[model samples]
Target: MPDRIRVLHVDDDPAVVEAATSALEQEHCGITVETATNVADGIERLDSEAFDCVVAGYDLPEQTGVEFLDAVRKRSPDLPFILFTSEGNEAAASDAISAGVTDYLRVDGGAEPYARLAHTVVDAVERTVDDIKHVQNTRRERAIEELHSTARAFMRATTEDAVAQITVDTARAILNMPANGVHFADGDSLYPVAWTARVEELLGTPPAFEAGESLAWQAFETGEARVHDDITSIPGRYNPETDIRSEIILPLGDHGVLLIGSCETGAFDDTDVTLARTLSVHATAALNRLDRDRQLREEREFIDQALDTLDDLFYVIDTDGSLRRWNERIPEVTGYSDEEIDEMSVSEFFPGDEHETIGAAIAETQTSGRVTVEAEILTADGERVPYEFAGTRLTDADGTTAGTVGIGRDISQRRAYERQLERKNERLDEFTSIVSHDLRNPLAVAEGNLELARTECDSDALDKVSRAHERMRALIDDLLTFARAGETATDIESVTLADIVEDCWQTVEGPRATLVVEDDRQIRADTAKLRRLLSNLVRNSVEHGSADAQTPSGHTAEHDGESITVRVGIVEDADRHGFYVADDGPGIPEDDREQVFEEGYSTGENGTGFGLKIVQRLAEVHGWTITATESEAGGARFEVTGLEPA
Candidate 1:
């Protein structure tokens, strides 16, 4: 990311070091040179600071150049190491090659050697950056893909039981845990509505437990998640299932409890705990929406009188534009009582010739049954404020206009919002063009160079170049996705996990990776966006899960992540439904877990840090929610919820 290049030149001859350092910096646009007299000082500089490349002489006072290379390799392996020495023979070249030097340059009479070394240093640093980026992008893509698949399953759940079923399936497919129970709460007890073999026998009756009695009851009463590692060790009158050694009870607010149990003790960990909490929260929201819709249906008879509680101005006018009736809200805003408004013509609220416009609006309402206008209205204080008035004409049985009912709202805030949105759209348009053109073009060029570099040399430097290229590409991609996520989704339909996952995985580059499909649930989503989302998630898993797979090109650095296995499936708990993606690799650490989705935060050297941000944005586009935790194989697990049945 830094435009300036910094290289450390170390040698025993002061004159040669000064000449080369000065010549390299003078010739390059953004190169700065620093020097050390011996290898010890160079090693100290590396320890205390950072440099793009290390240029050292083949012969040093204390040791050979190979020894220095070996020592520096221990500290930083991926850093470019170049040998600038007097030895020009094949034996020396072979020794440098065996020592894993990034580049070799023999001392020549002129400035050509230094100039060539400078270019090599730049290319080597660029390659390292690419390698880091490649890994980051790969993992992000996988994580996003899993999130999308889970989202599809969540949206298809309509009923409470369906929600729980999806959650169970998600557990089996993604979490690789098959035992769970979805429960509903009665007045003083909990009843099993949906469940799997994990906790079936414990709650088979109409009511599973009395209020505040069992783990499920306790979760409901406290409105919190409960984890019992060893059920036999707990001294209480509980489910008393001998086969079940561990259980997790997550509260679904007032709805019920989601219970996932295991026959083996200590089968669950922190990731499961966090997952339970997240799914429970989602279940609560789904239940709330359903309850609200049900209540609205039952209370429709009193909707007419509810207008009085609204803040807008409400009034009735005759065909002549005379004010006949108005609500208390009108008086509060206009500084007029009901009696005064009743005595005044609706035209009186408009100053001067505007009354004619009101009269025409009233007449139009009488003819068409409804009319709306944005016009200025004068309050009692004589202040003209912008207002939007919508009116409907009341007609008799004979079809004669008797009066007009109208509502007026102040447009001041609406106007401000409109302007703000307009400006935001303009900025977004400008940004989209820049991302589509500026960064993308250069990225393509870099990618081409990376391929060239790979064919020219067989070293880990190519990995760095590839990673840096991916990081830039991911950033450009995130810009487009971010804008789309905030917009309304017009093309929505049921998307199947089995279908979407295959399509998404095909679009991303997965190295030494396998995708396992556990359940195929249908949920509502924009097909294209869902594919994009899943692609990013899967990429994330593939790259991050294999954190140890990378080998820093020149140094002795070792990474264990080269291949990974990702699982996608549906998850259910008592009264809640969702889906998940799990991997078999090094899981995310607990300390860095909360900030994973944050903008521009990354642990990977080449990461653009926008990958998860894109994932979260796409989720908002579909009105879904997501969370991250550890997977069953000590890898990351991401769950998505807030779904409705397709």
Candidate 2:
């Protein structure tokens, strides 16, 4: 009912033909009849036109209905052939059926039999069409299943040419075409890249479909597939010694086109068109993969060239602390070539004592994402060089650690500069002590004479002179402490904090001061430097707290032991680890906290600011940070952090 079914009726009798035609016309509106009066005419009709059903009379001129059925079977194997006759016999019926006739109808003498013949022809045509469709549908389903089975193989193909040829072969087998070809677009021309079944010989030349010269161009121009039953009928179609009757052109997106041709006229069916289109999709995917792979290869090459131009030693280490790759700077810095480095691990470039430390640092970076540390790496000549190193963790798409990438910056020159600066400061400290010593002796002599003169008579002028001499002595002693601030602790050993604090308390001239050892933590330090730092802090606290503070006579005032209580305790934070010194007294002003460590920054007339400055200098020598803040009782507090504890 979806389309018209063409019926061919061949007979030697005009009356019988007229009856059959009239009956079929009245019975079936979807059927159209083409009449032939003889066997020769029937054969001609079958060859030229596509017919759904063929009905023939048994008594034909020169050929019987059975013979004519055999001729139709040879031309169209699956076309419905029917025999309608008046002289019907069992033997002749068997013959007609054996000749591949779909049905046999007896021409009895009534319109009822004629009507039955018409119905039989229609039924025969519908059944044959359904059978042919079922076969085609089965083929299509099989082809689709085969496509999935081979898809992985096609994707894994390493070469573009291999994939292209595989696509052509797959399309040819699925479509049941005798010839096929795969073409790609190369700038201005579309040329065949792979072909099968003498497709090139059939074209008489390598087919070129460019400049809109052939019907194949329509696929590229419209971005769609096209089918032609007779390719030779199109204008500018190629002629050849061999035959190629039907062809289909499928576009590989904007990349290229695929062509498949057959030798039988109108050989391609609707199923062929669908299969060719599906092949086009797979071909396009292969082409895209190839293009992207080429682009990545070029990008990687560029990155390698860029990294080689850098001066710093840039390298990548595996997750296990093994060297994976490095730049040309590696050989320049380590005196090892790329070939030798390939067999070395990153940990091999460090001393044996530091190998475990650095390895752990790299593992920690992988877990924590980044780490920065200073260490030494060894060169080929067994020389150790200090380097400032930083490592970062690299991850793949799934967010797992792929490796560790790091940069090593040599700091030998920086270390040398620091040593030179330290030598200059030590000399300056010596000159300062000599000058203070020279001035202190003259001031002491002047003070002794003034005191002797004061003993003779209580002169207000003499008292003021005596007080000025005492102040000058205090100034000289503060200058001496500031000059010796450059000296660092030479010998580091495990010393108890409480023991050091008790010893330092005896050295300061603060008899009214109270000491509280709140923490008994053990630390690595120089005993002399720790005593000096603690002594200065205690003196500063007592002088600021007592009513009659420590005088310039190197003695604490008698304040009935009512002085500041200084406490030493551990101070720990998210980023700091060390101790704090706090005092219960009138705290330093908030405005002056920032300048507390600067020389000559006095909070009051009795205060010598060099005490806090000495505290800061010794803390820096030990590589600690000192910060001043308020204590819990609204008193002054100095925190020294970033200490290595035992």
Best by lDDT: 2
> Model 2 over residues 346-402: C-alpha lDDT tens digits?
877888988887988888888899998788878899888888888999898999898
Q: Model 2 lDDT vs. the true structure?
A: 0.80
Which pairs in model 2 have colliding backbones? Answer: none
Which 10 consecutive positions of candidate 2 have the poorest summed lDDT? 550-559
TM-scores, one per candidate: 0.41, 0.60
